[model samples]
Target: MSEATADVRDAQLAERKRVAAATVDTHRDALIALSHRIHENPELGFEEHQASAWAAEYLQNEGFAVELGVGKLPTAFRAELRTGPAGGPTIAILAEYDALAGLGHACGHNVICTSALGAAVAAARALDGLPARIVCIGTPAEETGGGKIILIENGLFDDVDAAMMVHPGTEHLMVRGALACITLTVRFHGKSAHAAGAPERGVNALDALVTMYNSIGLLRQHVKDDVRIHGIFTKAGDAPNVVPHLTEAVYYVRARSHTYVREVLEKVVACADAGARATGCTMEYRTDRMYRERRNNHAMAALYQQNLESFGEHASQPPTHGGVGSSDIGNVSLVCPTIHPYVAMAPLGTAGHSPEFREAARGEAGDRALVLAAKCMAMTVVDLAADPSRLAAAKAEFAAAQQAEAAE
Candidate 1:
């Protein structure tokens, strides 16, 4: 690049940094308040009307053109801001605000939503002379249905060049990938009768459930180390004196990749079927509408890592063995360049979905994560906007990974 062009780019970067730094205090307070509000309200997936509306309104106030109800989901929306020429690359900042069942913000989604919002606002204000389009997509139902998968199917991310989101975990760093997973419900039905009077005439559905659980436990030893099969009995016998007529369970089957997840899910279903056959009870199983697996976008992840480093934070190195849980964002990686990095909000070993993590979501540590995540995300957006080669590289990596997965 010519010296003149380099100088201009440097000037733009400096100006963006200045604007971001100047507004940090104001944005910080807004983010903290937003996080607390969402944490207190805590709605479940696909039903986060208040969370979605508040995010849209906040961005609209910050000069973004907000579009409510992007897909069939009532709580899903998109906010867009454009700068410079129209031909610039479009970078997407993803926001998720859904809460866990019964735990409110235990998974720290409250932090994720506010952080993404703060980042987008900073990006919008700083992109005065940059050649890029900024888009903040409000995706619902990360805890239940894969909202991003639905949005992708609806062609929401078709034209977007790259996407990024930060998740609050036990540590502050990027997660290279997440496990692919499928949720399923299994039901068994049998004839009910008085246990002491006509035990022979009644088929016990609870026995079928116990048999299924045992079968899965035995099957686990044969699967790959990366695979996980876990379930909970949602329904069982009501009273010991009566033979239960019906029973049900919910299961989550996970694998390192989509193909493996599909394979393991089939085996799990077979186990459930065997249990039903052994117990002489009719059984039915249904998989949830969405399935997602691990997503490792190295190029985009590295870019975000570098941006984080620029703000005095370092990305965590991948472990030599073992992997984290699954996420719907895994599905998004299959379609486009995407990064789901982890920003530390709680201390190490503070597990997600627990009461401790939920408490941490509102404390000082959570507030720090919110600010750091926002800065890193905003800076990464600037990086993507200022450099075209990086975007090309990210897209190339994404295509290669998708092709490799398809071939496998």
Candidate 2:
């Protein structure tokens, strides 16, 4: 492209970004109301019926073609708005609405989902003959169910050019990685007998569970630094006096990479098998869907950070080590160019999934973060839609990352 034409295109893109930011400001009140409403009504994974419906309704009102129960998930939905004709590049803005058990909105998903809604509507309004399609996907059950992972299997992201979402955190960060994770449930069955009178005839299932737990504790020492294995006893025993016939436990295994996590998971399960063999108790186990590690597209993240800084909200230096968790968005990232940045919502050091974080999600800081994140994300979408070169760079980066993973 000629320098003068490039300059003109840049100017046009700047104007669209301004319009998108203004559009976000225009819907500030409605967006806040939606965030507050979802905050007030706390729902668990796969059960965010009210939250999902409210989000879908709002998008429908904004002229997005809304579809509820997407990917065969009851609380999942997809809303689409095309700024131009068909065959244009598609950008997906993902929304997660599941609340933590016992603690409501502690993860600031209220901000996550509402910000996405605002960004989609604002971007759609700002586009001027841009050949792009903006899609807002209501991904439910981030707290438990792997909704995005299922969506990927359902081919929801097959046509997507890029995906972006902002999570509410203690500080703004353009790149935060998540561990790949999987859940395991184990049950042990043994013969019940009187503890005091006929203890010899009884096979203690609790002993087997305890043996497995201890074995895992030892296994943890041999694993990599990023590997995390934790579990809780759901059914240890009915009573302390009686010989327990059944015991069950649930565990979460996580690692920096999916392949390594699977390798570690096998070792962890072998411990359980050893426990069963040693205690003469029959054992059975099952694992839930895997949540892949995040692949943050640096090209896209730089654009998001640039847009975020334009609002005078600079992101903190990216963390070098330690602070990481798993999310289903990682699965989406593996399929297309994706960025999951963080917008500050609470003071630094405030623990996520806690009561303090829950309150912050509905407080003034939370509201500010929601609006600002929406504006930033909307402007970032403008960057992708207006400049083909920017999108090309992001796609190139994503392709390289995929190729590297495949070679590994």
Candidate 3:
């Protein structure tokens, strides 16, 4: 803690930062090409064959050991870059490339995966003379399926020292806390009959669905602002003249934490039950994978912010009031010290999952942001590789946060 020691450490970091930035510039062409290729293809999660293959091939070309079809997911992959020694600290940078069903790369995952790839490669080439292992994982199906959750359960991250990824968003941020979420499939069953001849002879399931939807609208006023409930009607009736025999809807219930999500979902389901009973129909519901809230590691975020600022791009604070969605990275944060930061790829206030955002994911601004993100993440990895205490501090922060949440 002496002044002389601190000065030496600062000088060492400055040199590493220079090397990191230069290395990212060296690989700019390949990184930009990869990002655009993924954006143009726009494959959905769990079915990203071309995207996954290109990513693995790129890493393989860069001399990293690659493993495809990781964690039993056909499109998932794991690539590694080892330097100086065999058993050094390992830093894993996550990559998400799957696009939305109809919107293509509207969520900017194209920039996400390529930036992670660029970061891993840049960090490996930093010439800091540090012993470390860089891991880039191609995490598929993050849009719907919990790809990272499955990978963690399969022991993919069991040996990782820290995990990080830069998401493409409207603004640069260390991390925006995500809400816990659950997807529900609700079905209403009723008897069918001819509407014109004998409308009263059969129960109308559409009525039940409409009633339940209205009930949810009213229920939203009673819950906390952190709670978000929304859904769409998937089925109502085959024709206007015939009484609908079945109706279906899919709803997503989200809250600040898992407990609150379940608490709100229980009441939401009750509304459906009442609607079905009043309409003489039967209601049934099922849920998909539940996503947990993300926990950001303070020390780790600070390091990333500092590294980003070193590149002259200021990392801004996220909006305080808004409905934040969920991510599979939340599950990884629960098990390890992880960071899901954001690097701005479009103008401020650009809405995610929109056409504007989709274009930005491959435009000039996105390419610039990708290079910046790579430099920042690689510089941060340099800090972790050269200094063991950086990893320990991140882990300690994560452990403390997890413990506090558990105690609550």
For lDDT, the strongest prediction is 2
User: Candidate 1 lDDT (Cα, whole model)?
Assistant: 0.85
Q: Count the backbone clashes (under 3 Å) in each candidate.
A: 3, 0, 0
Residue-by-residue lDDT tens digits, candidate 3, 296-392: 8878899999888766778787668674889999988888898989998889888999999999989998998899888888888888887788889
- Candidate 1 structure quality by residue, lDDT tens digits, 1-408: 999998998787767766765565578988899899999999999999999999999999998999999977789999998877777988888999999888899999888898889988888777776668899999999988889889988988898888889988877667565788888899999889999999999999999999999999999989999887888999998999899989999999888777788888888889889889998999999987556765667887887787777777766776666657777888777777888889977888888899999999989988988888888888777777776777888889888878887887
Runs in model 2 lying further than 4 Å from the true structure = none
What is the TM-score of candidate 3? 0.94
Q: Model 2, 180-269: lDDT tens per residue?
A: 999999999998999999999999999999999999988978999999999999999898788999999999999999999999999989
lDDT of 2 at 147: 92
Error of 1 at 319 (Å): 2.6
Each prediction's TM-score versus the true structure: 0.93, 0.98, 0.94
